[model samples]
Target: MDEHESGAAASGASGRLARYVVAATLVRSADGGAVVAIVLLAHASGQPDWASGLLGASITAPHLLGPFIARRLDTARDGRKIIAASALIHGTFLGVAGLMLPVTWAVVPALLLILSGMFGPMLTGGVSSRLPSIVGRSQKSQRRAQSWDVASYGISGTLGPAAVAWIAATSSPLVATLALATAAIAGAGAVLALPRQSPLHDPGTVPSPAHTLGSIWRFGPLRRTLGLTVIVAFSVAVLPIYAVAVAPSLGDAALAGTLVAGYGVGSLTGSAVLMAWPLRGDSDKLTSVLAAVVAAALLLVIATPNFTTALLAFGAAGIANSLFFAATLAARSEYAPLETRGQVFIWVGALKIAAGSAGTAVAGTLISGASWLPVAIVAALSAAAATVCLIQRSKGRT
Candidate 1:
């Protein structure tokens, strides 16, 4: 292509990526915020705590079927429509659930929300899976877009919870829920702006779903990358729990909220750094090193002599965790085979939600023991995950 044509292509890719990033960020913001808002709403509504628990579970539980949902998306002529549909569905149910919680609808709210979450992948990794086709598959184009895309996750994570809490505090949990629905609706509109892409992958080459799960093992980079993601997800699931647990020792029980906020800010910082300077060199090595950083940082949180030091450690852990995730995203984009890429991304996202849910359960049990107990376990998990990745890397070289 001539220089002018090359420049035009670059410009078009940039415009498309910009829209995708916004839609992804807003959609995810609503998704995570809804999870938090419902629990708060249930508590405020004076229903049994289990009512809120059920509401949250209803949202995440459907993600387990992501592989199947993603297969249908893979075969669809335009995946963007599915993405837009998911956002609309999520927003619609979320708004209705907010209204139903304080009224007589009762268990029906969870049932309705479940219908929306069945399309959950389209809100997350399903959106990400389109980045290569949307942004152009060239190394430079893909890397830049991947960095921006992962950074959007950090932005959404931090924004979602913070917005929900602020609105819930100033207004009401019901209001916060309604606001999240609006964000999802806006995100759906932005998603429709994304260029329609025919499934870039070949369906004929895909194997049975059982072997697809096994395929992660055969792909060295994808295996290590996603394995680390699961371990990190587990540790992060314990993050708020341990943050709250450690607060009393720091001399103020109120530090719990501050420490969690610190971690979120640190995560945004790390993601911003990568967006500014996109990752280079061997990604596996970078991921392993980041995993060790996360472990050491948590250990520092455990061993610190002062609250200030402990707070810094929390920030450090957050930074490493986000950086590690960005590397994971790049790995998935680079290594996941073309045929089953959609299903792979979607399944990986579901596995993360499952691991995180399990981790939250285990952390809750262990958190009440000693303040140091849960943090120590999280650190150990990070360390162990790194070791496994290093071993796999060595084997891959052979």
Candidate 2:
């Protein structure tokens, strides 16, 4: 085939892969929501808070391992196989977990950890690998594609939580889990249908995953982007806690659930906005400014007494989140080589998970003893510090 014809064929395949990737990601989010409901059920069944926290940790802990595995397996040819396998494994585990429900708290967490470990890398690797094929050699197209991916994530995130709420309210948590398992199984099937060929690879040079990660880290823009991403993750971590703290003011615990759902909705809207107008300027600077906005919005969330005001504040925070995510992903894709994109993306995922965990734990503890305002203030300060660091790093890069 001629170059144009070859490019057209590759683009067609990449578009199909991107759709499947988005579907897979949505299914993964569904699984995550089911896991969250399971943890909540465990707590309701008289499990200790610490035990529930452990279960939550189990769901997230595999993020630490995913990058390491991606580093080893994220090559041009084999990465798709790894992704497909991971999806199968994830579906299998989810099925097993569903069958074993109501067995013990310990078993639930163990299964969740195994499922997460397998699924995490697959999700990140699949998306990152497709970037080159979708965007080709155009820098502008790459940025737009990154925004599109973030928009997909935001949509999935909103739907997942809503699905959890619906399932948990009308039926049982087990039923919710079963739905999640079904989604996972469907996603695995979709992955199996993806085109086997990838366009990101150069036949002459195959870079090691570690080298790819190192290159991404060494890039001035990416490094700054990571810093800002940490802030975004940290701020997001505090959100659930903020919902809990504001629950009393809103009149009930159920309102807390609504608040969280509202945040997701806001995020979905924000992502749509970004997709419509993808970030184009220096991503490093844009990320910092978004971080500052997130900080301000978070503080507004905590300070507001009424539900109406709180919803608006949280919505603004969600906008900040969408902006930050789009810019960071765009910048990271620009800075990282295609061969090692999976590894680079996975490392960023790891950092986001770690920062989020720390932020949630710290925010939860602080809110228990001190006022919510203090937690908000601290979170804002942390965001501000991250923003300053990002700005300084960007200046250094220039």
**Strongest candidate by TM-score:** 1
The digit string of per-residue lDDT tens for model 2 on 1-398 reads 99999898778746864775566575556545655765655655566777766665665677667766775444445455666666666656665665554565466656665665556655653555555554556656666667667766776666665686688779876676667666766776666665554634463354655665666667767777776777678767888887887787687867887787777777877777865777778766777777777777777777787888877777877877877787777766666665566777777877787788888877877777655754566566757766676657657863
TM-score of each: 0.93, 0.84
Instruction: Pick the lDDT winner.
Output: 1
Task: Tell me model 1's lDDT, rounded to 2 decimals.
Answer: 0.82
lDDT of 1 by residue, 1-398 (tens): 99999999889888898888899999999987888888889889887877778988888888787677676666667777878888898899989988998886568888877876776767888888888888876676677788888788888887898899999999999999999999999999998899887665566666665677788867777777777878878887787888788788789989988888888888888878877887786777778778878888778777887789878877887888878877777777777877767777887788888888988889899977887888788889899989878887887741
At residue 274, give the lDDT of candidate 1: 77
The stretch of ten residues in a row with the least summed lDDT in candidate 1 is 200-209
Alpha-carbon lDDT, every model:
0.82, 0.67
